[model samples]
Target: MKKQITSVSLGQNAKMAAALYVVISLPIVLVLAAILAISGQAGQALVVLVATPVVYAGVAALGTLIGGWLYNVVAARVGGFEFTTAEVKAG
Candidate 1:
Protein backbone atom coordinates (compact mmCIF):
# COMPACT_ATOMS: atom_id res chain seq x y z
CA MET A 1 0.00 0.00 0.00
CA LYS A 2 1.10 3.53 -0.75
CA LYS A 3 1.58 5.87 2.17
CA GLN A 4 -0.57 8.99 1.92
CA ILE A 5 0.66 12.51 2.44
CA THR A 6 -0.72 14.63 5.23
CA SER A 7 -2.11 18.08 4.54
CA VAL A 8 -3.32 20.84 6.88
CA SER A 9 -5.44 23.91 6.15
CA LEU A 10 -4.29 27.43 6.81
CA GLY A 11 -7.43 28.54 8.64
CA GLN A 12 -7.73 25.31 10.49
CA ASN A 13 -4.06 25.48 11.15
CA ALA A 14 -4.40 28.97 12.56
CA LYS A 15 -7.29 28.06 14.80
CA MET A 16 -5.61 24.95 16.02
CA ALA A 17 -2.42 26.89 16.47
CA ALA A 18 -4.19 29.43 18.62
CA ALA A 19 -5.83 26.72 20.70
CA LEU A 20 -2.55 24.94 21.24
CA TYR A 21 -0.79 28.17 22.09
CA VAL A 22 -3.42 29.06 24.65
CA VAL A 23 -3.23 25.61 26.14
CA ILE A 24 0.49 25.85 26.47
CA SER A 25 0.70 29.50 27.44
CA LEU A 26 -2.31 29.99 29.66
CA PRO A 27 -0.33 30.10 32.90
CA ILE A 28 2.33 32.35 31.46
CA VAL A 29 -0.09 34.59 29.61
CA LEU A 30 -2.25 35.16 32.66
CA VAL A 31 0.64 35.69 35.01
CA LEU A 32 2.61 37.98 32.73
CA ALA A 33 -0.39 40.03 31.77
CA ALA A 34 -1.46 40.50 35.37
CA ILE A 35 2.04 41.54 36.40
CA LEU A 36 2.35 43.90 33.48
CA ALA A 37 -1.00 45.47 34.14
CA ILE A 38 -0.27 45.88 37.82
CA SER A 39 3.06 47.48 37.00
CA GLY A 40 1.38 50.01 34.65
CA GLN A 41 2.31 47.89 31.68
CA ALA A 42 -1.31 47.46 30.66
CA GLY A 43 -0.40 48.58 27.18
CA GLN A 44 1.99 45.73 26.83
CA ALA A 45 -0.54 43.27 28.09
CA LEU A 46 -3.08 44.58 25.61
CA VAL A 47 -0.52 44.20 22.90
CA VAL A 48 0.06 40.64 23.96
CA LEU A 49 -3.65 39.91 23.91
CA VAL A 50 -3.90 41.35 20.43
CA ALA A 51 -0.91 39.30 19.36
CA THR A 52 -2.17 36.14 21.00
CA PRO A 53 -3.98 34.91 17.89
CA VAL A 54 -0.94 35.24 15.69
CA VAL A 55 1.26 33.56 18.26
CA TYR A 56 -1.31 30.84 18.57
CA ALA A 57 -1.27 30.27 14.83
CA GLY A 58 2.47 29.75 14.83
CA VAL A 59 2.26 27.36 17.75
CA ALA A 60 -0.56 25.46 16.08
CA ALA A 61 1.45 25.06 12.90
CA LEU A 62 4.38 23.73 14.87
CA GLY A 63 2.09 21.37 16.74
CA THR A 64 0.57 20.02 13.54
CA LEU A 65 4.01 19.37 12.14
CA ILE A 66 5.16 17.62 15.29
CA GLY A 67 1.98 15.57 15.52
CA GLY A 68 2.28 14.50 11.91
CA TRP A 69 5.89 13.57 12.38
CA LEU A 70 5.17 11.54 15.47
CA TYR A 71 2.33 9.76 13.74
CA ASN A 72 4.49 8.99 10.72
CA VAL A 73 7.29 7.60 12.83
CA VAL A 74 5.59 5.85 15.73
CA ALA A 75 2.35 4.90 14.08
CA ALA A 76 4.12 2.91 11.40
CA ARG A 77 6.25 1.05 13.87
CA VAL A 78 3.40 0.27 16.21
CA GLY A 79 0.52 -0.15 13.81
CA GLY A 80 2.30 -1.28 10.65
CA PHE A 81 0.82 1.54 8.62
CA GLU A 82 1.16 5.16 7.64
CA PHE A 83 -0.68 7.98 5.92
CA THR A 84 -0.64 10.06 2.73
CA THR A 85 -2.67 12.99 1.42
CA ALA A 86 -1.37 13.44 -2.08
CA GLU A 87 -3.99 13.90 -4.75
CA VAL A 88 -3.45 12.94 -8.38
CA LYS A 89 -4.81 15.15 -11.12
CA ALA A 90 -6.02 13.87 -14.46
CA GLY A 91 -6.00 16.07 -17.48
Candidate 2:
Protein backbone atom coordinates (compact mmCIF):
# COMPACT_ATOMS: atom_id res chain seq x y z
CA MET A 1 0.00 0.00 0.00
CA LYS A 2 1.12 3.55 -0.69
CA LYS A 3 0.47 6.48 1.59
CA GLN A 4 0.45 10.05 0.35
CA ILE A 5 1.51 13.05 2.41
CA THR A 6 -0.68 16.03 1.63
CA SER A 7 0.36 18.60 4.21
CA VAL A 8 2.59 19.20 7.17
CA SER A 9 2.51 21.30 10.32
CA LEU A 10 5.28 23.57 9.15
CA GLY A 11 5.93 25.68 12.23
CA GLN A 12 5.62 22.95 14.80
CA ASN A 13 7.57 20.38 12.84
CA ALA A 14 10.28 22.84 11.88
CA LYS A 15 10.80 23.99 15.44
CA MET A 16 10.88 20.47 16.82
CA ALA A 17 13.29 19.18 14.19
CA ALA A 18 15.49 22.24 14.52
CA ALA A 19 15.67 21.84 18.28
CA LEU A 20 16.65 18.21 17.95
CA TYR A 21 19.26 19.08 15.32
CA VAL A 22 20.73 21.77 17.57
CA VAL A 23 20.92 19.42 20.51
CA ILE A 24 22.62 16.73 18.46
CA SER A 25 24.99 19.05 16.62
CA LEU A 26 26.11 21.15 19.58
CA PRO A 27 28.47 18.50 20.88
CA ILE A 28 29.91 17.89 17.44
CA VAL A 29 30.49 21.60 17.04
CA LEU A 30 32.24 21.69 20.40
CA VAL A 31 34.49 18.87 19.31
CA LEU A 32 35.35 20.69 16.10
CA ALA A 33 36.21 23.78 18.16
CA ALA A 34 38.43 21.70 20.38
CA ILE A 35 40.20 20.26 17.36
CA LEU A 36 40.81 23.70 15.95
CA ALA A 37 42.18 24.90 19.26
CA ILE A 38 44.52 21.96 19.46
CA SER A 39 45.72 22.72 15.97
CA GLY A 40 46.84 26.22 17.08
CA GLN A 41 43.72 27.91 15.71
CA ALA A 42 42.44 29.18 19.00
CA GLY A 43 40.85 32.27 17.46
CA GLN A 44 38.89 30.21 14.96
CA ALA A 45 37.93 27.72 17.62
CA LEU A 46 36.51 30.48 19.84
CA VAL A 47 34.48 31.85 16.98
CA VAL A 48 33.13 28.46 16.06
CA LEU A 49 32.28 27.63 19.67
CA VAL A 50 30.39 30.88 20.10
CA ALA A 51 28.70 31.05 16.73
CA THR A 52 28.01 27.53 15.50
CA PRO A 53 25.06 26.55 17.67
CA VAL A 54 23.17 29.80 17.12
CA VAL A 55 23.83 29.85 13.39
CA TYR A 56 23.11 26.17 12.98
CA ALA A 57 19.81 26.35 14.84
CA GLY A 58 18.63 29.37 12.89
CA VAL A 59 19.58 27.88 9.53
CA ALA A 60 18.11 24.52 10.34
CA ALA A 61 14.80 26.03 11.36
CA LEU A 62 14.59 28.26 8.34
CA GLY A 63 15.60 25.51 5.96
CA THR A 64 13.08 23.10 7.37
CA LEU A 65 10.27 25.61 7.08
CA ILE A 66 11.14 26.49 3.52
CA GLY A 67 11.60 22.89 2.53
CA GLY A 68 8.29 21.88 4.02
CA TRP A 69 6.52 24.67 2.19
CA LEU A 70 8.13 23.71 -1.10
CA TYR A 71 7.30 20.08 -0.56
CA ASN A 72 3.66 20.93 0.04
CA VAL A 73 3.51 22.87 -3.19
CA VAL A 74 5.23 20.21 -5.25
CA ALA A 75 3.24 17.43 -3.67
CA ALA A 76 -0.02 19.18 -4.47
CA ARG A 77 0.94 19.33 -8.10
CA VAL A 78 2.34 15.80 -8.24
CA GLY A 79 -0.40 14.04 -6.33
CA GLY A 80 1.64 14.24 -3.14
CA PHE A 81 4.20 11.74 -1.86
CA GLU A 82 3.94 8.01 -1.74
CA PHE A 83 5.46 5.52 0.70
CA THR A 84 5.01 1.91 1.59
CA THR A 85 5.22 0.31 5.00
CA ALA A 86 5.79 -3.27 5.96
CA GLU A 87 4.67 -5.13 9.02
CA VAL A 88 7.01 -7.36 10.96
CA LYS A 89 6.18 -10.09 13.40
CA ALA A 90 8.00 -10.10 16.72
CA GLY A 91 9.57 -13.25 17.97
Candidate 3:
Protein backbone atom coordinates (compact mmCIF):
# COMPACT_ATOMS: atom_id res chain seq x y z
CA MET A 1 0.00 0.00 0.00
CA LYS A 2 1.08 3.58 -0.67
CA LYS A 3 0.39 6.59 1.49
CA GLN A 4 0.49 10.24 0.60
CA ILE A 5 1.42 13.32 2.57
CA THR A 6 -1.05 16.07 1.90
CA SER A 7 0.53 18.96 3.75
CA VAL A 8 3.51 20.08 5.76
CA SER A 9 3.84 22.81 8.37
CA LEU A 10 7.00 24.05 6.79
CA GLY A 11 7.53 27.42 8.42
CA GLN A 12 6.55 26.43 11.93
CA ASN A 13 8.58 23.26 11.88
CA ALA A 14 11.56 24.97 10.32
CA LYS A 15 11.65 27.78 12.87
CA MET A 16 11.20 25.51 15.85
CA ALA A 17 13.94 23.17 14.69
CA ALA A 18 16.21 26.06 13.90
CA ALA A 19 15.67 27.53 17.34
CA LEU A 20 16.49 24.23 18.97
CA TYR A 21 19.65 23.88 16.87
CA VAL A 22 20.75 27.38 17.85
CA VAL A 23 20.21 26.69 21.52
CA ILE A 24 22.09 23.44 21.38
CA SER A 25 25.02 24.99 19.47
CA LEU A 26 25.50 27.92 21.82
CA PRO A 27 28.05 26.24 24.04
CA ILE A 28 30.14 25.03 21.11
CA VAL A 29 30.11 28.49 19.60
CA LEU A 30 31.21 29.99 22.89
CA VAL A 31 34.04 27.55 23.19
CA LEU A 32 35.27 28.27 19.67
CA ALA A 33 35.08 32.00 20.40
CA ALA A 34 37.13 31.51 23.55
CA ILE A 35 39.71 29.55 21.61
CA LEU A 36 40.06 32.30 19.05
CA ALA A 37 40.48 34.90 21.78
CA ILE A 38 43.11 32.83 23.50
CA SER A 39 44.92 32.56 20.20
CA GLY A 40 45.16 36.38 20.02
CA GLN A 41 42.29 36.82 17.54
CA ALA A 42 39.96 38.71 19.84
CA GLY A 43 38.19 40.54 17.03
CA GLN A 44 37.49 37.33 15.17
CA ALA A 45 36.41 35.73 18.40
CA LEU A 46 33.92 38.51 19.05
CA VAL A 47 32.52 38.23 15.56
CA VAL A 48 32.25 34.47 15.81
CA LEU A 49 30.53 34.59 19.15
CA VAL A 50 28.09 37.26 18.06
CA ALA A 51 27.33 36.09 14.56
CA THR A 52 27.51 32.30 14.69
CA PRO A 53 24.13 31.74 16.28
CA VAL A 54 22.34 34.19 14.05
CA VAL A 55 23.90 32.81 10.89
CA TYR A 56 23.44 29.20 11.93
CA ALA A 57 19.80 29.76 12.78
CA GLY A 58 19.12 31.54 9.52
CA VAL A 59 20.77 28.80 7.50
CA ALA A 60 18.95 26.09 9.38
CA ALA A 61 15.61 27.78 8.89
CA LEU A 62 16.17 28.31 5.18
CA GLY A 63 17.50 24.79 4.65
CA THR A 64 14.59 23.24 6.50
CA LEU A 65 12.06 25.21 4.53
CA ILE A 66 13.64 24.19 1.26
CA GLY A 67 13.94 20.57 2.37
CA GLY A 68 10.34 20.46 3.56
CA TRP A 69 9.11 21.91 0.30
CA LEU A 70 11.10 19.40 -1.70
CA TYR A 71 9.94 16.53 0.43
CA ASN A 72 6.31 17.50 0.07
CA VAL A 73 6.60 17.76 -3.69
CA VAL A 74 8.48 14.52 -4.08
CA ALA A 75 6.32 12.64 -1.64
CA ALA A 76 3.21 13.75 -3.42
CA ARG A 77 4.45 12.18 -6.59
CA VAL A 78 6.23 9.15 -5.13
CA GLY A 79 3.53 8.43 -2.51
CA GLY A 80 5.55 9.44 0.52
CA PHE A 81 7.61 6.64 2.07
CA GLU A 82 7.19 2.93 2.71
CA PHE A 83 7.55 1.03 5.97
CA THR A 84 6.52 -2.21 7.63
CA THR A 85 6.06 -3.22 11.23
CA ALA A 86 6.22 -6.52 13.11
CA GLU A 87 5.53 -7.31 16.68
CA VAL A 88 8.49 -8.28 18.81
CA LYS A 89 8.34 -10.24 22.03
CA ALA A 90 10.60 -8.96 24.77
CA GLY A 91 12.39 -11.50 26.88
Candidate 4:
Protein backbone atom coordinates (compact mmCIF):
# COMPACT_ATOMS: atom_id res chain seq x y z
CA MET A 1 0.00 0.00 0.00
CA LYS A 2 1.24 3.51 -0.81
CA LYS A 3 1.33 6.09 1.91
CA GLN A 4 -0.29 9.38 1.00
CA ILE A 5 1.50 12.53 2.02
CA THR A 6 -0.22 15.59 3.48
CA SER A 7 0.66 19.00 2.04
CA VAL A 8 -0.48 21.03 5.03
CA SER A 9 2.76 20.46 6.98
CA LEU A 10 1.92 21.41 10.62
CA GLY A 11 1.39 25.06 11.49
CA GLN A 12 -0.34 25.70 8.20
CA ASN A 13 -3.07 23.28 9.15
CA ALA A 14 -4.43 25.82 11.62
CA LYS A 15 -4.71 28.44 8.89
CA MET A 16 -6.16 25.89 6.55
CA ALA A 17 -8.76 24.89 9.12
CA ALA A 18 -9.69 28.53 9.65
CA ALA A 19 -9.99 29.09 5.93
CA LEU A 20 -12.11 26.00 5.67
CA TYR A 21 -14.34 27.27 8.43
CA VAL A 22 -14.81 30.57 6.64
CA VAL A 23 -15.60 28.84 3.38
CA ILE A 24 -18.14 26.66 5.08
CA SER A 25 -19.83 29.54 6.86
CA LEU A 26 -20.43 31.59 3.73
CA PRO A 27 -23.39 29.71 2.30
CA ILE A 28 -24.94 29.42 5.72
CA VAL A 29 -24.67 33.16 6.30
CA LEU A 30 -26.00 33.99 2.89
CA VAL A 31 -28.92 31.72 3.56
CA LEU A 32 -29.45 33.05 7.04
CA ALA A 33 -29.12 36.61 5.88
CA ALA A 34 -31.59 36.00 3.13
CA ILE A 35 -34.02 34.49 5.57
CA LEU A 36 -33.46 37.41 7.88
CA ALA A 37 -33.86 39.83 5.03
CA ILE A 38 -37.17 38.30 4.20
CA SER A 39 -38.15 38.52 7.84
CA GLY A 40 -36.79 42.11 8.15
CA GLN A 41 -34.33 42.34 11.09
CA ALA A 42 -31.73 39.78 10.06
CA GLY A 43 -31.98 41.00 6.49
CA GLN A 44 -31.00 44.52 7.49
CA ALA A 45 -28.20 43.20 9.57
CA LEU A 46 -27.19 41.01 6.73
CA VAL A 47 -26.96 43.97 4.40
CA VAL A 48 -24.70 45.81 6.83
CA LEU A 49 -22.78 42.64 7.51
CA VAL A 50 -22.35 41.96 3.84
CA ALA A 51 -21.11 45.51 3.31
CA THR A 52 -18.49 44.98 6.00
CA PRO A 53 -16.15 42.00 6.03
CA VAL A 54 -16.11 42.00 9.82
CA VAL A 55 -19.54 40.36 9.91
CA TYR A 56 -18.30 37.58 7.73
CA ALA A 57 -15.46 37.02 10.16
CA GLY A 58 -17.93 36.89 13.01
CA VAL A 59 -20.17 34.51 11.13
CA ALA A 60 -17.17 32.33 10.38
CA ALA A 61 -16.23 32.22 14.03
CA LEU A 62 -19.73 31.27 15.03
CA GLY A 63 -20.04 28.86 12.16
CA THR A 64 -16.76 27.18 13.08
CA LEU A 65 -17.88 26.64 16.64
CA ILE A 66 -21.31 25.44 15.59
CA GLY A 67 -19.96 23.40 12.72
CA GLY A 68 -17.32 21.79 14.88
CA TRP A 69 -19.81 20.73 17.50
CA LEU A 70 -22.39 19.67 14.95
CA TYR A 71 -19.82 17.62 13.09
CA ASN A 72 -19.29 15.54 16.18
CA VAL A 73 -23.00 14.81 16.61
CA VAL A 74 -24.60 15.03 13.18
CA ALA A 75 -22.63 16.28 10.21
CA ALA A 76 -19.66 14.00 10.44
CA ARG A 77 -20.82 12.02 7.44
CA VAL A 78 -21.59 15.05 5.35
CA GLY A 79 -19.08 15.92 2.66
CA GLY A 80 -16.91 18.99 2.96
CA PHE A 81 -13.34 20.01 2.29
CA GLU A 82 -10.63 17.63 3.34
CA PHE A 83 -7.04 18.55 3.66
CA THR A 84 -4.78 17.35 0.86
CA THR A 85 -3.45 14.58 3.03
CA ALA A 86 -6.80 12.85 3.48
CA GLU A 87 -7.47 12.84 -0.26
CA VAL A 88 -4.12 11.31 -1.08
CA LYS A 89 -4.56 8.73 1.62
CA ALA A 90 -8.13 7.95 0.55
CA GLY A 91 -7.06 7.65 -3.07
Candidate 5:
Protein backbone atom coordinates (compact mmCIF):
# COMPACT_ATOMS: atom_id res chain seq x y z
CA MET A 1 0.00 0.00 0.00
CA LYS A 2 1.03 3.61 -0.55
CA LYS A 3 0.51 6.40 1.92
CA GLN A 4 1.08 10.08 2.41
CA ILE A 5 1.12 12.16 5.58
CA THR A 6 -0.59 15.26 4.29
CA SER A 7 -0.82 16.94 7.68
CA VAL A 8 -0.33 16.38 11.35
CA SER A 9 -2.24 17.42 14.44
CA LEU A 10 0.23 19.58 16.30
CA GLY A 11 -1.49 19.36 19.66
CA GLN A 12 -1.78 15.60 19.46
CA ASN A 13 1.80 15.18 18.26
CA ALA A 14 3.08 17.45 20.98
CA LYS A 15 1.17 15.64 23.65
CA MET A 16 2.34 12.24 22.49
CA ALA A 17 5.94 13.37 22.12
CA ALA A 18 5.90 14.97 25.56
CA ALA A 19 4.53 11.80 27.11
CA LEU A 20 7.06 9.64 25.28
CA TYR A 21 9.89 11.91 26.34
CA VAL A 22 8.80 11.75 29.95
CA VAL A 23 8.52 7.99 29.85
CA ILE A 24 11.96 7.65 28.23
CA SER A 25 13.57 9.99 30.75
CA LEU A 26 12.11 8.38 33.82
CA PRO A 27 14.57 5.55 34.12
CA ILE A 28 17.61 7.73 33.47
CA VAL A 29 16.32 10.18 36.03
CA LEU A 30 15.72 7.40 38.49
CA VAL A 31 19.26 6.11 38.14
CA LEU A 32 20.72 9.59 38.41
CA ALA A 33 18.64 10.27 41.49
CA ALA A 34 19.77 7.08 43.07
CA ILE A 35 23.39 7.93 42.38
CA LEU A 36 22.97 11.42 43.79
CA ALA A 37 21.26 10.11 46.90
CA ILE A 38 23.93 7.50 47.37
CA SER A 39 26.50 10.28 47.10
CA GLY A 40 24.83 12.11 50.01
CA GLN A 41 22.78 14.62 48.03
CA ALA A 42 19.25 13.53 48.66
CA GLY A 43 17.93 17.04 48.16
CA GLN A 44 19.59 17.37 44.79
CA ALA A 45 18.38 13.90 43.89
CA LEU A 46 14.84 14.84 44.77
CA VAL A 47 15.09 18.02 42.77
CA VAL A 48 16.47 16.20 39.76
CA LEU A 49 13.79 13.53 39.89
CA VAL A 50 11.04 16.14 40.07
CA ALA A 51 12.37 18.83 37.74
CA THR A 52 13.76 16.76 34.90
CA PRO A 53 10.40 15.47 33.72
CA VAL A 54 8.87 18.95 33.53
CA VAL A 55 11.80 20.26 31.54
CA TYR A 56 11.95 17.23 29.24
CA ALA A 57 8.21 17.34 28.61
CA GLY A 58 8.26 21.03 27.80
CA VAL A 59 11.19 20.75 25.43
CA ALA A 60 9.87 17.68 23.71
CA ALA A 61 6.40 19.13 23.27
CA LEU A 62 7.66 22.41 21.92
CA GLY A 63 10.08 20.76 19.55
CA THR A 64 7.51 18.33 18.24
CA LEU A 65 4.94 21.10 17.79
CA ILE A 66 7.36 23.22 15.82
CA GLY A 67 8.51 20.30 13.73
CA GLY A 68 4.98 19.20 12.94
CA TRP A 69 3.96 22.74 11.97
CA LEU A 70 6.97 23.08 9.76
CA TYR A 71 6.26 19.76 8.17
CA ASN A 72 2.73 20.81 7.36
CA VAL A 73 3.91 24.06 5.82
CA VAL A 74 6.53 22.38 3.74
CA ALA A 75 4.25 19.58 2.80
CA ALA A 76 1.73 22.09 1.53
CA ARG A 77 4.33 23.58 -0.76
CA VAL A 78 6.25 20.48 -1.84
CA GLY A 79 3.82 17.72 -1.16
CA GLY A 80 4.00 15.18 1.60
CA PHE A 81 6.41 12.27 1.77
CA GLU A 82 5.19 9.08 0.17
CA PHE A 83 5.99 5.57 1.25
CA THR A 84 4.88 2.06 0.66
CA THR A 85 3.84 -0.48 3.21
CA ALA A 86 3.03 -4.16 3.18
CA GLU A 87 1.31 -6.36 5.68
CA VAL A 88 3.14 -9.38 6.95
CA LYS A 89 1.37 -12.67 7.02
CA ALA A 90 1.34 -14.62 10.24
CA GLY A 91 3.16 -17.86 9.79
Candidate 6:
Protein backbone atom coordinates (compact mmCIF):
# COMPACT_ATOMS: atom_id res chain seq x y z
CA MET A 1 0.00 0.00 0.00
CA LYS A 2 0.99 3.61 -0.52
CA LYS A 3 0.31 6.60 1.66
CA GLN A 4 1.03 10.28 1.74
CA ILE A 5 1.76 12.54 4.69
CA THR A 6 -0.16 15.66 3.78
CA SER A 7 0.16 17.64 6.95
CA VAL A 8 1.36 17.45 10.49
CA SER A 9 -0.28 18.40 13.78
CA LEU A 10 2.02 21.17 14.92
CA GLY A 11 1.08 21.09 18.60
CA GLN A 12 1.43 17.37 18.97
CA ASN A 13 4.66 17.31 16.98
CA ALA A 14 6.14 20.07 19.05
CA LYS A 15 5.12 18.41 22.29
CA MET A 16 6.68 15.12 21.29
CA ALA A 17 9.85 16.83 20.07
CA ALA A 18 10.21 18.63 23.37
CA ALA A 19 9.83 15.40 25.31
CA LEU A 20 12.30 13.60 23.09
CA TYR A 21 14.80 16.45 23.35
CA VAL A 22 14.68 16.27 27.14
CA VAL A 23 15.12 12.52 27.15
CA ILE A 24 18.03 12.69 24.70
CA SER A 25 19.71 15.53 26.56
CA LEU A 26 19.49 14.11 30.08
CA PRO A 27 22.64 12.03 30.01
CA ILE A 28 24.78 14.73 28.43
CA VAL A 29 23.45 17.35 30.82
CA LEU A 30 24.04 15.10 33.84
CA VAL A 31 27.62 14.45 32.85
CA LEU A 32 28.35 18.11 32.22
CA ALA A 33 26.76 19.03 35.53
CA ALA A 34 28.74 16.35 37.32
CA ILE A 35 31.96 17.67 35.87
CA LEU A 36 31.15 21.20 36.92
CA ALA A 37 30.21 20.09 40.41
CA ILE A 38 33.46 18.19 40.73
CA SER A 39 35.31 21.32 39.72
CA GLY A 40 33.71 23.23 42.67
CA GLN A 41 31.19 25.12 40.55
CA ALA A 42 28.32 23.62 42.43
CA GLY A 43 25.96 26.53 41.88
CA GLN A 44 26.62 26.59 38.16
CA ALA A 45 26.29 22.86 38.10
CA LEU A 46 22.95 23.07 39.79
CA VAL A 47 21.73 25.64 37.31
CA VAL A 48 22.93 23.52 34.43
CA LEU A 49 21.24 20.48 35.88
CA VAL A 50 17.92 22.26 36.14
CA ALA A 51 18.08 24.45 33.10
CA THR A 52 19.72 22.56 30.26
CA PRO A 53 16.91 20.14 29.59
CA VAL A 54 14.27 22.81 29.86
CA VAL A 55 16.11 25.09 27.48
CA TYR A 56 16.85 22.32 25.03
CA ALA A 57 13.27 21.11 25.12
CA GLY A 58 11.93 24.58 24.53
CA VAL A 59 14.22 25.11 21.56
CA ALA A 60 13.36 21.74 20.15
CA ALA A 61 9.65 22.38 20.48
CA LEU A 62 9.88 25.74 18.79
CA GLY A 63 11.98 24.36 15.99
CA THR A 64 9.61 21.47 15.47
CA LEU A 65 6.63 23.77 15.35
CA ILE A 66 8.23 25.97 12.74
CA GLY A 67 9.42 23.02 10.72
CA GLY A 68 6.00 21.42 10.81
CA TRP A 69 4.35 24.60 9.71
CA LEU A 70 6.78 24.93 6.82
CA TYR A 71 6.21 21.33 5.86
CA ASN A 72 2.47 21.91 5.79
CA VAL A 73 2.87 24.88 3.52
CA VAL A 74 5.24 23.15 1.16
CA ALA A 75 3.16 20.00 1.11
CA ALA A 76 0.08 21.90 0.11
CA ARG A 77 1.87 23.40 -2.86
CA VAL A 78 4.08 20.51 -3.96
CA GLY A 79 2.18 17.55 -2.67
CA GLY A 80 3.12 15.61 0.42
CA PHE A 81 5.69 12.88 1.12
CA GLU A 82 4.75 9.59 -0.38
CA PHE A 83 5.82 6.14 0.80
CA THR A 84 4.93 2.52 0.46
CA THR A 85 4.11 -0.05 3.10
CA ALA A 86 3.24 -3.69 3.15
CA GLU A 87 1.69 -6.02 5.66
CA VAL A 88 3.74 -8.95 6.83
CA LYS A 89 2.44 -12.44 7.09
CA ALA A 90 2.76 -14.48 10.27
CA GLY A 91 5.92 -16.48 10.48
Candidate 3 residue pairs in backbone clash: none
For candidate 1, lDDT tens digit of each residue in 5-89?
4443445655666677778776777777888899999999988766665676576777777766676576456663445566789
Summing lDDT over every window of 10 consecutive residues in candidate 2, give the lowest-scoring window.
Answer: 49-58
In model 2, what lDDT does residue 41 have? 100
Residue 73 lDDT in candidate 2: 90
lDDT winner between candidates 3 and 6 = 6
Cα distance off (Å), candidate 6, residue 84? 0.4
- How does residue 87 of candidate 6 score in lDDT? 93
Model 4, span 33-76: residue lDDT tens: 77777777864766644543454555555655665555544433
Question: Where does candidate 6 clash, by residue pair?
Answer: none
In the range 1-91, model 2's lDDT, one tens digit per residue, is 7788988879987898778878977898889999999999999998988788778788888998999999889888887778998889999
Backbone clashes in candidate 2 total 0
Candidate 1 is scored at a TM of 0.47
- Candidate 4, residue 70: lDDT: 55
TM-score of each: 0.47, 0.71, 0.74, 0.41, 0.90, 0.95
Tell me how many clashing residue pairs each candidate has. Answer: 7, 0, 0, 2, 0, 0
**TM-score for candidate 3, residues paired by index:** 0.74
**Model 4 residue 20 CA deviation in Å:** 1.0
Every candidate's lDDT: 0.68, 0.87, 0.85, 0.54, 0.96, 0.97
Across residues 63-89, which tens digit of lDDT does each residue of candidate 5 receive?
999999999999999889999999999
Q: Could you give the candidate ranking by TM-score, starting with the highest?
A: 6, 5, 3, 2, 1, 4
Candidate 5 regions with alpha-carbon error over 4 angstroms: 87-91
